[model samples]
Target: MTTVTLPEKTPAHTGRTPGRPGRRGVQPLALNIVALAAGLGGWALLSLLGFEDLPGPAQVAARGGEMIADGTLLDDVAASLRRVFSGFALGTLLAIPVGFLMGWYGVARGLIEPYVQFFRTIPPLAVIPLAIVLLGIGETPKIFVIFLAAFLSSVVATYQGVIDVDKTLINAARVLGASDLTVFVKVVIPASAPFILVGMRIGLGSAWGTLVAAELIAAQEGLGFRMQQAQLYYDLSTIFVGLITIGLLGLAMDRLLLLAERRLTGWQERR
Candidate 1:
């Protein structure tokens, strides 16, 4: 027993497993940090290399902090968010029924499809001047433009989703004596929901993009207005701040929609 026996050997790679949940979660966070650091480093280098007009990260941070302290940034953010939400809500609400009707009924499709195609071909930005003339250079025009952007983007997706539903499933439901309304409510709607949500995400992006052009018409207090004013003064830092804020806000909203999609579509099999 006292013969100098070595202890039992353990696996050398006995640390965290490669596919562990903790590692999976930490990887994205680590990568995000690294990416942010690299971007800031590159920005700083460029500014030091005599891009005199370009604002460094530090300069942008300082300007943003100043705006935050004076409550200007918050006001702009709130105003922009309000318009986006209101317009997005209006558009999505109206689009879902219109889309369902177009997809579900032949008469609805025949009447509406041509108009939808015509309007959708016209960019929301292109409609801004008309909107201003018709609705006035006020909140109504801006909201209307945003509404069109969201509505057009969503309606097509919703329509296609319904059209793409599994034909077999509908036949099965019919064989089971399901009524038209029952089949639509139980089969079509559930099948098309994912597409509808995807459309909403696209619509949200369109809404944000069109908001800038809409605000350009005559906004007094949104992020787009803030950036335009900064540009007039040649204030690069504020311009960067506004651009970054919009990017980050849009990213956050997109992620939320993705989260919703995952939750709603959990019934689908993973690869």
Candidate 2:
């Protein structure tokens, strides 16, 4: 009875770690809520401290209620949302292909990067006058300014992503007899997607700022226009309402993009 040898093996994953399933999520949200409350408290305190022109959260909420009652808030929200979406879509759609090309091809990069960098140095607001002159003081100007904002912010990010892709992966594809287009479509795009999403997020912020400037100078409606009108009469509550509305809108949009980024780039890991 030669009992040779017995081996004991340990399992890799024993059991679920308590409170480890997306635990990071709740803490940040809790912290954010705390921070928000503190910020509101501070603002209220300051308003009470002889800041006669400053409107606190309650005043802003009341103004918001009035705007909602009159339906101006709803109309302004819809109009601003439409402009942001349309312009952002147009800019991103164009930026992707152009960025991809510039990143992939040396000739394209050489020819296009100068113009891209030059135009990016010019503030989106700087182009408003030119856009207005050429496209007229209509939806076209507003949309064009937003488009420029998104385009400039995103292009560099897109190019950087493509450029930063692992050279080894590209070489491996080539060794496996993959064509240039096949390598780009199958490998490069997927690898660079995270960078593209970051670019898009930045572009979205730029779009909002540019849209507000355009609206302030020319438009008759939207949140920017509403704020401008409020400013005329020194209506602090209304001004506060407009500011908060813009902040909320931008934050919501950013969060939506962040969700999309997580879904789209699930292969990437975060700490």
Candidate 3:
């Protein structure tokens, strides 16, 4: 009894460290902001060094404002956006069902794989002539070009995603009493969403480029048409303006897809 002793317990805060929530996140973002500012500053300096061909950000911004005021820019942007969305929607809608069929059905896969691969190798630009020949120089050919862009990319991605889905997961679903349709709907589709989205992003970019090519061939509207007009007049500034606008628009659309991807795939990190 006299020799009995108890060890002292440590206090909860004795050697504990405190953390600033989200502090790690802020630093990289701050560095990125600084880098962006420095890059813009360097661009401005370069523009001031007699680089007349290199349209400064300010010049592009001014031209953008002028175009907006004249209403042409907005109209072109809207028209281009509409074409992209419409074609993308049509392509993706078809691709999803077809991809699912090709992935799940052996006979369907054998039947469709060759055609899919054949068309996939053909460049969208190369197919422009074919599209025009088949559909004419109107919106049909243009949309078809965009549709091909989306279809090839999205379908391939969806097919690959479906094929690569974990067999274990499928087996687990089956063991849990999921019917084929239920398993596909509840598991396969959700699992393949990321790949499908990536395809959509690639497809959208392709569609934008294809839209420019499409507009180059007998079109009187859109940014590409405006740029062509500017080129004919030797208006380098206006051409640069249109080029920059196209880039900005593409960037905006890409960012929108990225945002959607982040939201849709939020659960990915937890895994």
Candidate 4:
């Protein structure tokens, strides 16, 4: 008599590895917490070592708490947020169309590229004097400089994205009878989305970097202005507070953009 062996059944794959559902989400948050703790620890250590002009984490936190209780912090935050958002939005909105034009049309590129490159060489800070002279010492100048910063950052990124789109994909779309508009809408835009989002993120940073100078245009009631005032009185703690507030705000906004990028470019592969 012969003994017959039967094949064992295997589990079907569901395209995802078996693990705790929230583990991946929790990991990044945990790492971020650790990083924050490490930074605070280093800062505290440095302050303890008598680093002149450097306020410790505890001192800064206490000052921040007082500002928060007085509602001064909130007001400054609101003002700064308003300026950054307004300028950044306008810059990005205009940049997308202009960048698309420059990338998609040779004639448009010829006309616009020269000016774009010209402006790119000049720092937004350099424009401040002119902005104040022309737009006056008002909110207009502050917002204008910020707008220029964001516009330059975003336009360059957007133009690069458009040009960097895969030629093969465009050709294939064309061969499949897709019209130019259709190809642009269906193929080019999606392919270029990652770069555009990255550019927007860079633009956001540039806007914040320009904020201190932007608020210097004979204005008041913002973080940068607060920091400047603090500087006059040698209020290191307040200066630290303003610096930290701006950093936190920028970090939060950048994280939001990062989330948007992840959602929009879900089709792209990653490590």
Backbone clashes for every candidate come to: 0, 0, 0, 0
Residue-wise C-alpha lDDT for candidate 4, range 152-268, written one tens digit per residue = 999998899999999999999999999999999999889989989999999999999999999999977999999999999999999999998999899999999999999999999
How big is the RMSD of model 1?
6.5
**Global lDDT of each candidate:** 0.91, 0.89, 0.83, 0.92
Off by over 4 Å in 1: 1-26
114-221, model 2: which lDDT tens digit per residue? 999999989988988788789988798899889989998789899999999999999999999999999999999999999999999999999888777989557878
Q: Between which residue pairs do clashes occur in model 1?
A: none
What RMSD does model 4 have?
Answer: 3.8
Best by TM-score: 2
lDDT of 2 at 203: 95
Winning model by lDDT = 4
Error of 1 at 70 (Å): 0.5
Worst 10 residues of 4 by lDDT: 9-18
TM-score of 3: 0.85
Higher-ranked by lDDT: 3 or 4: 4
Error at 18, model 1, angstroms? 17
Q: How high is each candidate's TM-score?
A: 0.88, 0.90, 0.85, 0.89
The predictions' CA RMSDs to the true structure, in order, are 6.5, 3.8, 4.4, 3.8
* Cα lDDT over the full model 2: 0.89
lDDT of 2 at 208: 88
